[model samples]
Target chain A: MRIVIIDDSGLRATVLEEGLRDAGYDDIHIVPPRGAFVARLERMAPDVVLMDLGSPSRDTLEEMLMVSRALARPIAMFVDHSDDAMIGAAIDAGVSAYVVDGLRKERVKPVLELAVRRFNAFAKMQTELDEARTALSERKIIDRAKSILMNQRSLSEQDAYALLRSSAMNQGKKIVDVAQALITASDLLGGGL
Target chain B: MSLRIAFLPLTDAAVLAVARERGFAEEEGLSLDLIRSTSWATLRDRLVYGQVHAAQMLAPLAVAVTLGLSQQPAALAAPYKLGVNGNMLVMASDFAAALDPDTGRRLSDPLGTAHDFAAAIGLWRRKPVIGVVHRFSSHSLMLRYWLASAGIDPDRDVVLRVLPPSLTVEAMRAGEIDGFIAGEPWGSAAVEEGLAETVAIGERIWQRGVEKVLAFRTPWLEENPDIVDRLLRALIRSASWCDDPANHDALAQLLSDPRYVDQPADLIARAMSGQIVVRQGEAPIASPDFLLFSREATPFPWRSQALWIYSQFVRWNMVEHGPEALAKAGAVFRPDIFRRALADADVPMPGANMKVEGALGLPLAVGSRKGGLTLGPDRFFDGRVFDPERMEDYLTNFVSPL
Candidate 1:
């Protein structure tokens, strides 16, 4: 019932570990992002390995555990042939698993499902963080564009905002898009805001 | 009208890129969304899980997938071959310097160099670790064949590390592996950066050796014949365009885009044009037929080729040898589907589905159903032929490395 999580991102691995811990699986090990991975995995002798699909070392793991039969016990990729939906969700969530051969599907299914849920949650949080960063950057761009409009046309902030909104509506674009266009044009005209 | 295909970033992905970028896919009323994947395993998962309609897969991998050697057993079908013979075997400069001084001769005579390699392995500081892209890859199988011929047991004499093609050069720089066999322009990139020297070309091991095949889930391909036909048509056009020397520059540029191979255009161009730089600051060697995308039915999925891969699997003990396993492996390459798709096209189609592999010593024009076709010079480096009908007899010739 030992579990090993192989991930380059410490944050994501910690998230998955916390989820697994809450599920009451106490025997858990986390392999660091890089280094002599095969030797470490051999030493750990994990009953099940949960790996990030994006890691390039997955191939190395495959060669050692699957092809070369370097491990004393055979390990097969955890595949629930009956649950295609779950498998698809796991792959989309960027998580993959390998388990010691002959491990029952029932024993591993909940663990895999939990990993998938945690991965999806982590991915959503990452998306939100990226969007928040983008929002901050775009807000700066819009402010710059507004100031350029206010300074060049000798208008107030309210007037510059209304002009940007009107231009966005007429051109069937977002206000941010129009603001970005204005900034680009202003930069081309050698004007600084 | 829309199809998503997953592919690893390599020069052999040129057909897929050309089909999408050159408007061939558009001309056939199809829209192709090419997903650049980081590894072969992920690409297989994407195709198996229905995230992608198809994938640019290693031919042996497609067979292995069907045979249930990797991951969940999915009936993956490869109806079209993306390209052939673009892989290079590169060893670190220090290790290669122990072999032949003439880089061109080293590649030209792989068997001689392989013996030299065996001799040099003892002279090395430690057991040389050779990086292969995947365990179920053609390059790995070829490396096994090339090394075993010199009595250098791949498993005993060397360590085979599996690294993605993109990471090979960096792996070399980090001193993690002594050499690697992978598709270009990763090999070219490594040689260009002066991290490694070319020891062998895949083409020299087996002329017109199978590389990447356009793979799809069997059920999807079976259920949607019309879409498959259209895709094959688009790929055929793209492959012809890719094979033309006149279009090498444009094709190289197209593949150099961030979304594709993402290497320098000049480096990518070498593989396509068959002009390779084996060593840093050395003159390029012209092999002329190094990589083939089309012409001589390079795009055709020959069933014999799949059986050849199966033979390697049995040789290496990767899969249990049995009638059921053999049938499953051979069926991975669908020549029937390929012929059905190209039935009405102006291009020539081979009359038979299988042939004696490595039997074609020189290019010979053969009778075809649609037009004139020539196939050949598909000789093995060891000069052995693989007859699909006599697989047992063919396999008896090899002494198992185990």
Candidate 2:
């Protein structure tokens, strides 16, 4: 299977290439840390893709999801994370899978297996965390949203949150979206939502 | 006006289901369309571009959005909290057993798991790594929180990495990971399959803290206040239904639907019921439920909870670059909108300093349910007594206005 690994991690790409080669499969190309990933991955046009979870920004992934979803040029092939359930879990966690349209499962399993392994490696590190407070990388957004809710709706802490939670439910939205909305709303509402 | 919303699939995604099912949006004279988003970034983009009016999002994602992490013109805003404490920390069973049986069977504090976890890393000589679903999730923060509290430097001491929830269990059993922190059922399933054991529930440590929130574009809410209000009312109702014990089964079925957790209905139901089977070759046993979709469990947003999150943000340096982090958090966390929604629904809102008892009592559903006889605590970590009025200063401190 001619595969292109679109990932930001060198170790992951190496590990996957090695594993796939070991499994008697080799037509593999690695794309490491490049901007405009969608364009490059498509330019490469490999039969299968072994992408990494948490590799790029949410915007990047969303673009990829849309590109794959809309164009059907690349279907969301499963990550080598483990199995179908794990890929679903990744999707739930905001990661996605893309494959070339009409790619057969046999053509992708080798690539998927490697992607799953690398994804597994990352999962190993994460499970050992034993708690969820590790995201210094992503805390800025949550705090900003909380602050907006507090200032705008005149919400006293939890009430602002209830506003967020209820909004998510009533609007069938995500908490993050509700938070983003409140900040946007505050800006438009002139500091009061 | 019709507002578009993108929802990530999780137990908490029920807000979307409840909103649509309850007809709250229609009642408010607003058109609602919920798009099931596969990833957080997609949800964020759809919401940001006005493609979707709102979303069921990560609490931290909203905060991150407002801070301009995504470099978007729009910022996530709202004091509205989506949900709380539907997370768990899990370890493979053999890994747990290897964690020094010398510590004795009767153990307190999940830190024991951490200690054993560190030891397991050493014993297995496995990478001292763990998995979280995303970089910007409560699981990541709580993993850091628990590890840091245990004096394990989350940064230097161990390698902190991100992975999808699906891989956590297999990773643990395969020795790819010694342990993991996630929403639910993953840990329980590990224990059930003899692949892992539950070290703690996020609820056990932080209690009913806000884990997720609804986010909207600032322009969207300003343009449509009535729609926002309507959205909240339905959410409040959904939260209420989730709280009822009888609805647990129904919720599990709802969540297990292909659109929700998408696992088997029974698996989703068991997780909701807190029925955990942590050992392979053994019967499934009950454990503390995640209480994601549970009600009364949903509303009553706690400033203390928000403050708790902010403290961690400050502790980790995630609060920088924002003007008056505390004020910003205060501004975003809206008790006002919450009260309006709950009051409109005729549900008595819990005080900002309310000391309400947990709806799910300890010793879940009766005599002799395995793992000894015990009930979950109704207390906080400080043991100084949790009070809302006292938490204001701390929460306000989350973002000190410049």
Candidate 3:
């Protein structure tokens, strides 16, 4: 797996790099401390990111948050210390693991593994949430279309539902998609249905 | 009570460090875990999210967080102030050359130096980029206030970059920023390394200016009043010890530990003792009262001081002025809590919760819970008085078309 290390301190970065290499991770990249960092990370496209913020300011923390939000890769952050607000922000920004005051060479592999595992678990849960939300919204749209049909055509709810299903099957689209199209047409045509 | 406190590695963190190291907390029946943070934002976050019981936080930052400028609005309370007036503004040697030639005079007279700085800005090669620790930091606000006095627009005339105080020297060395205003040892560190020269000291800008405070989430403070009281009492004793002349050397040594400021003993000593070396090869200048710990009830969390910080937020357009927000900002400084915590102690505190900020021009006797409290000069260099009661009027004095 490609790994990236983000640390402003050269000595700390070197130590982290050596530890990662010792752990048999050959593909490693170090992010430069300055310039367009997110763009650079996107181009590097590492599977895992190990960030060492020796002492981060609010601006640096915000920048790191943006990186975490943009990248889908599992990231582990090492800091001398952290506060609750920053940790909350890091978690919200999708940082998989945040290790504070335990950045020794011997501890690297397990932390990396945990970070990846946690990130994958979180990503899976996020995907499930997105799917559930999509389904719920689709059901809402389908119900709205059914009610519009029932109101305009003087049909029962079951007949309106059947009409939507038939229309979806004939058009080779999901029922929700067909319903959404019908709603859009009704609204665009001044609801003249 | 077992309390885990987060703090940045600066000299001002002495009270917390001493409390943990000197067994002050243990004496108060509390076990203390002091975590050294690198940034104010992280420390603020730590307190807000309940990762730590409390934190050594920037006074303005606490207000800003409550005002919802820095992060999600959290009602943070500062029942005690850790230290006052311990920061400095250091400019690159080349840039410093353009300012007043006489270093001693410039350092002594802030307003004259500010005028000199205004003139120097015109001759500079570029709009000088000055690094400030944080947007909501007292250093940045003071920098703005000092620069504005000479008709220099901080927003337009110069570039203010945000960098951690520890990284300030490297940024200046890399030519990324021309100068930086940060808390002690970092400024002293730059001077020691011959990377920068001290141009402005926070003590001279506004004597006894509020810097760091003991901050906690309001809910946490309210829930653990007994613990908070214990911590404050411990902190009060620690502050007195930290202020003792005999303890300065030991305090400097403690701060130099890798887990703390992690700098040379002498660099930390200079700021701690109020004898700062503005430039390399220069004798240390006596800047007494440079960093106050407990003298004159320095730990007392004055509510008016909080309003003064809010007024700056308004002056800088960081937040829109509203009575509700103003009340919230002022409420962040919990003198009531301080009074409750120190009620039994020998500590003399102001009788009133608020005072006319920047009004004191000399050491004056003030009405106190236990009289005989003499406050040091609390004057703004520009001679502007901030009446907390008349915040709108105070703000109007700084109204411009910015």
Candidate 4:
């Protein structure tokens, strides 16, 4: 997996880079503290992002938050010290792992693995949520279309749904799509039968 | 109560460090955990999110947070001021050479130096990029106030870069920025390495300018009033110790720990004693009132000071002026809470919640709870007095860039 390390300190970046290298991860990129850091990360599109900030000012945190929001990769941030509020903000900004006052060479591999795992887990959950939301919205649209058909044709709810399913099967389309088209046809015809 | 507090690695964090190190917290039935953060943003977030019970925050930052400028809008409160007037503006040595030759005179006269800075800006090859600790920092506000007095528009004339104070010296070394304004000993660190020279001290811009504060989330503070009171009492005791000349060495040593400031004792001691070395190999200047920790009601959180910060925000067009926002900003500095915490202490408490900021030309007696409260000079270098009561008039008086 490709790794990108964002650190303002040259010395600490070297330490983290060396640790990552020893763990047999060679596709590592170190970003300096100048000129569109997030843009550079986007171009690199690393699998995981590691940031070691000696002291992160508000500006830096905001910039990092922008990157976290943009990228789907796992991100692990290491700081010399952190407050509860900062940690919360970082998490809210989508950081996978936040290690405080624990910048050691041996700790890097474990943290990286854990961060990637957590990120994958979070991504899976998010995908599930999105799928569920889309299904629920589609179900609502299908129900609305069924009710419209029933009102126009004087049919039962079950008959309206059966007609929708049969139309979808004959056209090789989703029930929601057929329902949507029927609703559109009725609306365009000024709601008459 | 067990309290975890966040602080930056600066000399101004001495009171918090000493409070935890010298058993002051323990004496008040509190266990203090002092976490050293690298930037004001992190420390502010720590307090806002309930990660730490409190934080050593920039005076303006606390106000800005309450004003919803920093990040998420959260009501933050400052019950105690940690230190006053400890920050300074430093320019690269090459940049300094273009300004003033006499270091002592340049350090003393802000107006003269500011004019020199304006001239230097003209002669410079490019728009000089100066690093400030944070956008809402007192250092940035002071820099803008100083530069604007010389008719130098900060936004148009120069590039104000945001950087962490600890990395300022390195940024200067890399030529990423030409100068930086931050709390000691970062500025002193730059001077010590022959990289920069002190241009204007915060004290010279505004004597006893509000700097760091013991800031807490408003909800957390309201819920834990007794805990807040205990923490304030401990901090007040620690502030007194920090102010005492006898404990300067010990305080410096404690601050020099790798966990805290992590600088040499002498460098930290210079700020603690108010004897600053502006340049390498030059005689240290005796700036006796360089930093005030406890005396002169320095710990009291004046609502007027918060209004003054709000005025600067209005001046900079950072926020629109409205009575509701102004009231919220003014309420951030809880003098009532300070009075409540230190009611029985030997320390004298100010009788009123607000005062005419920068009105005191010299040490003057003021009505106090315990009597004998003598406030020191708090004159703005531009000779502008800010009456908290007349905020709209005070704001209208300024020729703000907006």
Candidate 5:
């Protein structure tokens, strides 16, 4: 079966392509975000199309359905009646599929399942990367706030840290939030270390 | 009760936003979880698969989904109309110059400009590509209706490209499309940027025409009558608030939030107040009744309006016209539920479920349960009437280009 994946992110498309390749499906095409996507897909009439649910071009595909003459065989979304859980999972994972009408469900199920699994993996990796970046920035902010406190109040580093923790607890906010507030106040008051 | 509702960011979605932000939903003991969708296709899927309790949807899309034109066949119903007559057709400057030079007159006389558009097709650089929001959208159906009247085959003489309403301006700037027909703020944005000029307004094509409706899955609506009634009541109160002239400023400011329509406040205000700037740097033209949310029973979903949409499907060969298909399509608009929800309230309702569409030449007060109910003029520009009893004659009247 021929499959085409439409996604704007190159890395996500490459990962999905690699997963499909490993599953013994050789005819795979990746169409990135570019001009005239519908025309490109028309030239390569794939049996099944995999697309990111967030892509705005999905409406373009709907237009193709209206002008049926443009397509070889009318394509419909691959929504299996017997498998509601799998379909819901695919939607939650931001994956959608459109297969040429009369294509067997048995042939399309595995391909969609593989896409869902790959998309979830990519999402988890992205979340981890974002969290790591945020944590590093918060740490730097907290260190700067502690040093300013130590210099302005003539207190030790340990005492400064305790002061920030108590202030955060009193204000019902996070330590990073309190630390950021301290840094802003110090800069505004011309007392930056 | 908490209900999740899906909607696109457009001026017509004002009712839902007002319902949630202004405490109308809370007053009825309901919490509305509004999910902003990027495309109508995704919004349909969300409502079809039980992700949302309801959605603000295109009228024909609700019918098309019931008929199973796209995706799996799922029965959907629209008990309340979100808004009416808020869409516009805009053409690029170079192509528009071929038509009437006076932009105000161009929109005022759509029939005359349509012929001019037909004559200008041969003078263009290439095939004119017009952007529509969706295949089963009201704007697309209206474009086809207006173009066919002037001997322009929408499918052959010109190209209909589908783009999201928000992306229409960018696409026009990129020269990917010559023009687009979409709901407000987007059309106003295009005109403000001097990229396009207004050719026709939907109100003139078919005055008080059906646009967006509050759609819900059939099974879900049947299972929870109490919840549905409460939500409709909330929407009724919200719609009244949106229609008031005194509230337009506050309403525009609320819609300008980044979480909603997310355009400039002044640009969004122009559509709500009906002071449209059709051309770049031109003085605003006052066209009151340009967009109506609740005035004159506007929220009522007449079944005859649904039949009008069904006829268009047959006109374009989108669906095979049959009694079974016609009944199914007409059943998509649930006026019975609308009446049931407002039975106890002081709201006045039309006594009939269906009427002859485009027959009303002027505002007429019809029989109603409560007193003081008047419907405004709803006439087609070509002076053709669509009577639900004579669907065959209406379909035969449109002479297709052989």
Candidate 6:
């Protein structure tokens, strides 16, 4: 039931430590990305060694390859199956995993489960942040689409949203789809579509 | 019509690049599609599995695939030698200058430059670490073969590691590696940047060594024999175009562009022109056959080159035993396929076997070079003489005149 976290991120480690503590895990330990990292890795020998997903310490991880191999410990990490396309993206993104061998597969589930949740949470946060920034641009696209609709049918703002909503209901499409379609068609026509 | 053939974008991959930019592929109803791959393993995987129809591969890589050196119990049957030469050894300047006294003369062997290099490294106070692009590559074997011939222990005396050709210059600059053997742009780039000195051009070691070749999944080549023929014809034309001095500027431009080497064209042209640029501040020496794609270098698919590669396989214990080595080299190197490709385009085929004695020789004064056993150094670590006569014949069987 004991696990140690070895990551370069202090803030991430703090949050993980707090979360695990709240989740009733008493033997959770955290180590930073410097000296004492390997000693802690060896001394703690936790059931799981949870490191930050994309820290810029791959060389450190790579340097550990020989030592890990010499010790006959094969480390594997969670390859993001939920996002298959992300495998290449992750390799590009510097996301990698290393789990020591001899750890039972079933016992490692919790480790991977936590890592996936953390990664998903991080990804979801990124998506939301991107969306927030693009909200203005998306609104302008909708405005462009709306202007075209208004010019074509003399529909007001209220009528336009209503029409779009009704169209979504009929076609089972999202409002973004209708907005995108309208914007694309209008651009192609050299003005309002 | 253009065909999108995937290729690992390296400097020595001249024929494919020339075909695309010089309109040679088009001459044979082929459009060039050169995809960049990070590793030969990925290149082989994609080419073998049909993700990509064909590619410019390590000559031995094709042989390895055909011979099953890589994925044993699963051998690939493919045809064609893609291209040759344009590889060299680049050593840290300090190491290059530190020649061992016994080497007799100042280091001067270009073809087997690494062999003399192994001598220099062996006699060094510390075992010198050598870098090559890949474990299965000829660069690795060449370095090992040269070292073994000089009576040096490849494993004990030197630390060998693979650093991708693209990263070698940077690695040399950062001092992470002592020296490296890699194809064109990487070696040339090192000299241009003053990071490493060119120790030797590959042609001087094994003479007209087989460098790169087109390899495809057996099933793919079988189904598209006409396309293969067309592709080969285009490649040959590109090789011819590359050989012409008039096309030098164009070849340089194609490789220096962001799509290919993405380095300075002049540096790449240094190798492409067969001008041996030593990494040290020495003048560039002319080795006419350095980047040969056409002329006498084109056809013949010299069996000697294939045998040289097999000699290394035996030396390294990569083939611990048996006819697997010969079969492997035979399977991937399809001179027959290359000839078929050339014939369809009406390109005249060269001789079946070539005499490379002119390029084979020894260097004056190995640079701090240690001594190596004269034969297979790894499997026969006790300094036993391997049957070179037998090995040579085994290697020449598949690709020789027949």
**DockQ numbers for every candidate?**
0.63, 0.06, 0.18, 0.19, 0.71, 0.06
lDDT of 2 by residue, A20-134 (tens): 7888876888876343455566556566655554443333443444334334364443434345465444443433345666776666665554566656665665566633444
Per-residue lDDT for A23-69 in model 1, tens only? Answer: 89999999974657788888888899999887777877877787534
Model-by-model lDDT, in order? 0.91, 0.59, 0.81, 0.81, 0.92, 0.61
Q: TM-scores of the models, in the given order?
A: 0.94, 0.60, 0.75, 0.75, 0.96, 0.64
Question: At residue B251, what lDDT does model 2 achieve?
Answer: 73
- Per-residue lDDT tens digits for candidate 6, residues A88-138, read 443333233455656665655555555555655556666788889899777
Runs of candidate 5 exceeding 4 Å displacement: A65-71, A147-151, A154-157, A183-193
Best by DockQ, which number? Answer: 5
lDDT top scorer: 5
Cα miss at B116, model 1 (Å)? 1.8
Clashing pairs in 3: A83-B46, A84-B45, A84-B46, A85-B45
Q: State the lDDT at A21 in candidate 1.
A: 96
Which candidate do you rate higher for DockQ, 4 or 5? 5
- Candidate 4, position B1, lDDT: 71
The predicted structure with the larger TM-score, 1 or 3, is 1
Candidate 4 lDDT at A57 equals 37
Worst 10 residues of 2 chain A by lDDT: A58-67
Colliding pairs, model 4? A55-B38, A84-B51, A85-B45, A85-B46, A86-B45, A86-B46
Worst 10-residue lDDT window, candidate 6 chain B: B373-382
Q: Which stretches of candidate 6 lie over 4 Å from their true place?
A: A1-193, B1-4, B71-74, B100-107, B110-125, B279-282, B297-300, B351-389, B392-402
Residue A38, candidate 3: alpha-carbon lDDT: 52
